[model samples]
Target chain A: MRVGELSRRTGVPVPTIKYYVREGLLPPGELTSPNQASYTDTHERRLRLIRALLDVGGLKVAAIAEVLRAVDDPGRPVHKVLGAATERLGARHAEHDDQEAAEAGAAVGELIERRGWRTDKSSPAAADLARALAAMGRLGHGAFREVLDDYAEAAERVARADLGYVDRKVAVEDLVETTVIGTVLGEAVFNAMRRLAHVDASARLFGTRPEASD
Target chain B: MRVGELSRRTGVPVPTIKYYVREGLLPPGELTSPNQASYTDTHERRLRLIRALLDVGGLKVAAIAEVLRAVDDPGRPVHKVLGAATERLGARHAEHDDQEAAEAGAAVGELIERRGWRTDKSSPAAADLARALAAMGRLGHGAFREVLDDYAEAAERVARADLGYVDRKVAVEDLVETTVIGTVLGEAVFNAMRRLAHVDASARLFGTRPEASD
Candidate 1:
């Protein structure tokens, strides 16, 4: 298979495929001749993964490169790979570190302690939560913090379902790839559904839709 | 209060505040003395909402302006406002409308039907879900559709909790404002918590953390 076929099969442009190779996102294909190289099925699969992460996972190229490095390495611990997979998502909010941030941090600490959740206290997810809460505080919606426990309960169920899917469906060798897909695309799935649910609930409360229109 | 004081209170710069006013995201302050403008509490609150939507909701400035316009108009229906609030988020992925997208749309239709979800069939969230699934299919993880039911169940729980919070905690007058806060920041809250729960679950499976580190 030539690079053109790889591009055709993956629906990625030829130059974009070359750029990925240069970025080390995709390994260079076998160089059978000085000018032309042949790609394989692995190249096609890797290209698809890159597209999925970009289109759905919303990870930056650098973050995808890092996660791919971990996936390609055999000796990396599962926890370390998991950490890499989530690194980019944690910093979506800038940590302002102001008074509101301090208060938000304390609330996150309290929620974790109350839930007895066993995670690194200084984890990125905790920091992400605090930064988000601080943004809310700045907006005068600090009182919305009252529902952290409820959000945590919903998160717990989501996580449990994720674990069950991972444990039952994937082979041990495919852990890193599966983690990236499940974590990133899975988030998109839930966010869209939550919005749909919001519309449904509103229709129920308001009279825009028929009361029994299934 | 003057524009400077409003900026001081909201932590937005004076120039940025003016930009918001110019963008119609914030109502212009009253004409005070030809060259000066006087702002009020409404300006301050609106400024905060604009900042929150930009920072946490990750919505673009244009989307925020549209949502604010919808929010300011009392004649708007609840569903319409929600539709406006979620307008930007639905287009995160390019709607390729390829074969994979076509299949994904069918899957979303099936899920909505199975759940008896009362939503506009042509809603943005459903399209968003289909786009995400199309990306997954491109990655060769179409089998992941098997877990859509599990994801939907968790989403139902989250929607119920959001509705409960919106119902009991807010006044009728504050419905649109509360919906934006809840829909956007609440999204941040759940996403971060879901990541936290992932770390905890991985700890249970891997041995990097103490088995009983409560």
Candidate 2:
């Protein structure tokens, strides 16, 4: 297939596809002549994955490039690929050294230790957790830490389900992309459900309909 | 305190504070002279709230304005204020009427009915769920919906805990802002914890250290 057909099939404009190619997010098609290039089924598949990451995962182009690099690297372990993909999901912030952040980091370290988790304290996810806690403390919600255990329990259950789903895949080549999708899009799925549940719970508590206006 | 003092107190720059005033995200300090204005403790608190929404909650200026309007409206119910705040969390996409989106919408509607949730189908959160499911279908991960029940269970548990925390607050004035903080920062906290749990689970399954590089 040619770029035009690829664009038509994917509903992505030709110029955007060219931009993706230029940005190294998508590979260029094979040149059949001076002015014509051919794309393969693999290209179509890659394009769809690219679109999913951009639209649903909300990953930046450079981040997508990094994750795709890990996905395409056959020698990388599946867990490593998964880590690469999940790392991009966190916001990039300069690590804070304030007292609240320090205390929050200590709390995070304790939580990891208590759970017997093997993750490093310096990981971006850990930093994000600490940062969130620090922010909560600043907002006078430091007691929010009391619910951390419940959140952890729920997180563990969801993670187990996620891994179980991923474990059923038979192909090594398919594992990386599948993990990426499950991690990224799965977050979206869970978040939306959480909001729905919140509405349900709030309605029950307040004796109000969910559609009530402000 | 003057604008510069407000800036010094909040760590927000003078110009940024003025910008927020201009954007109506922050109310202007009272004019005391031709060139001087005085802000109050209320200004300091509101400034902090604004920073929390922008930094930790990842809310846009306009969304913050809507939420603040609800917060300032004493006539608004707490749940309504919450709805206003959470409405900004989901992406605002033009609604899709395609087959996959339609099917996903039906699935969302069914899920709501089965769970006895009172939310309208047109709610932003519901629309977000449908959009996510449609994107999953496009990516060949429609089976992700199989875990919807488990996700819902967890969401309910979290939501219950959240409302319980808010219910403990004694001041009616605190309810709306607290709910907003819990909803937004709580999402961040849960997401980070989920990623941490994923790291733990993946490590145990693969016998790899979480800190291992790709």
Candidate 3:
């Protein structure tokens, strides 16, 4: 398949695909001619995985590339790849003084400890936020650690509550991933849902909520 | 107050503050000379607000400018400004043409509805996702709606459970915002908690459970 076909198949665009190719994030398609090339099923699958790492997993291209490299390398431990990706998924800030950033990161860790959260130091989120803070530093921002703390406190409460639902139905890895994804992605998903909820709730109770945001 | 003073107070860098001034996100201070200018309390406050919007709200400078303009213009209804922000947040992905994008956004909206979440559509997060999606589109990637749907379903269950903790203690506004911030920010926090959970649960008689990909 050509770039256009891949685009059609994946719903991605040619220009963006080219950019990905240029970034070395995606393998170049087989050269069929000067202006045309062909892709394969692997390309499609790779593209899907890339999208998942990016859009769903919310990873940067550079980070996604690293993860893919690790996963594709059979010599690398799968748990290490999974561990790295999980760490990347957490709230990350890249711009902070090392002292403050580390302290702030530790603050959240300590809070979790105090709360009796049963987790490990190798958690993906702690790494994710730690990486994010390091990245935010280059962009000339450093308030992310404190901001993350504020965000974390509220999340702690929610996570504690959500555990009650497992009722032994989920496996540990499944439970952990879903819990992490839910806390992180859930905020985005639920906020959207909350908007919809408002509409229905208001319509049912008051006969109207504004049709949309004013 | 000098730039240094403002920097000390807000914890934002002097250069970034200058960047904000150059970008017209912040008004220029009283010019003392070619190399010097003095700020005031107003500047400090504005800087604080700017930091909050960026760090806590996760807004880009350009979008933050628009938000600040709306926030400052008393003639405009707060609701309108908020609505615009929410709309912007909801439309974060502008460039990707993935068929799954729209469905994911809609699914997120629906999941919140099913979970009985109540939030104002005018919240900053509404536009945050929209802007993110727009940037994502430019990258030639797509976030599938089903992935988000699966995420939302899992999140709803977690949120529903989390809600039980704060149901009686917090106001609706606080509950919703806390939940939103928690879900978003806490994803990382809880990952840390769950990393600990994984170790704890693994020690139990159940052993490791299934992974929840779908």
Candidate 4:
């Protein structure tokens, strides 16, 4: 197949295909002449894989390159590749498995304790969260363990209820990442979206939409 | 307060404060002398706000600046700021909205109509999910409406289950954001973690933890 045919088939531009070739993300087609080349099924598959990684997985070109290499490497364990990808994702913009979550929990816990908060152990964040704190302590961020544990408990409870709305649809994997990112950005998005919702409703009511029909 | 004191108070470093001042994010202190200028509580508060916007909100500096300006502006509706921020978060990133969720629904719907997929309107991904598609339609990413709604349905289900685990501990807002982020990353994490669990179990069965744990 020609590059144009590949482009037509994949909906990717010929120029972008050329760029991919230049970047070594795609192997060069067999040159029939200076301006003509032949492609193959392998090229189509590679392009599809790249598109999936970029579009579906949202990986950077460099990260995609690394992932492709790992995927193709015979010596590399698929588990390791998966692990690295997950860890990389979790560490995006926010550190997962770091002391921050634990510390945040502990800080709130100590404050609650100082304020004579009736410590609720039945809370999702109470004991196991304290276990996370102990893990943080072993990791050397022990100062705010207890306090962070308390906050973790509070955070856990609220998140659980919020998630109740989403539980019936997604797979377990999608749920976890969405929850993490949602937890991190959802607060901001929630407030922002809520405010925008009010604006949208008001605008529809006062500025755009017709009055309610009886 | 001196830069050192400001650092201690805000938990931001002197170097970072200097960078912020240089970047015009913070107004420079009144110069008592070239060597020593004092910061105020306003500076500390601004720094904390900046950190929260950057760290917790994951906003770029330019976006944060706009948000801060809108927050401070009495004339502007708060919702406009929220909309701007939400819009800045692209629909392609699964880290934020369930673009995949919406897309999946859309895909299924299209498939059912075109290729005769066994889609149920009463199915979790079919009914109210259409509302999400409608919302996305209004948002101008009309092409992605159906697929994104499908993803949302799936995500909503996962969120429900995950939240059930942490409901006793967290606050509503915190829980929502945490779950969103957690589930997004957790999806990836759990898959990886599950594999890791298997690997670790295999290692333990084969006696590899003490020698290879580090």
Best by TM-score: 2
lDDT (Cα, 0-100) at B115 in candidate 1 = 89
Deviating ranges (above 4 Å) for candidate 2: A94-96, A212-214, B94-96, B212-214
Residues A164-212, candidate 2: write the lDDT tens digits: 8777643556888888888788887888888888888988998988655
Candidate 3: Cα lDDT at A62: 86
Over B56-81, each residue of candidate 2 has an lDDT whose tens digit, in order, gives 76677888888788778787666676
Q: Identify the runs in model 4 with alpha carbons over 4 angstroms from their true place.
A: A11-15, A31-36, A48-58, A75-78, A90-214, B7-24, B27-37, B52-59, B75-81, B91-214
Residue lDDT tens for model 3, B66-140: 656655555543334334443444433424544444643454456445544454434445334443333333223
- Once fitted onto the true fold, the runs of candidate 3 whose alpha carbons sit more than 4 angstroms away are A30-37, A51-59, A75-78, A89-107, A121-124, A127-211, B8-13, B31-36, B48-58, B75-82, B94-214
**Clash pairs for candidate 1:** none
Better of 1 and 4 by DockQ: 1
Interface RMSD score of each model? 3.5, 1.8, 9.4, 13.8
Native contacts recovered, each model: 0.65, 0.65, 0.10, 0.01
| Weakest ten-residue segment in model 2 chain A by summed lDDT | A89-98
What does the lDDT read for residue B198 in candidate 2? 90
Candidate 1 residue-wise lDDT, A92-160, digit = tens: 653475899899999999998898777876777788788778887876668878777877887888888
lDDT of 1 at A30: 96
**Better-scoring candidate (TM-score), 2 or 4:** 2
Q: After superposition, how far is residue B12 of candidate 4 from its true place, in Å?
A: 5.0
Better of 1 and 2 by TM-score: 2
Give the Cα-based TM-score of candidate 1 against the true structure: 0.91
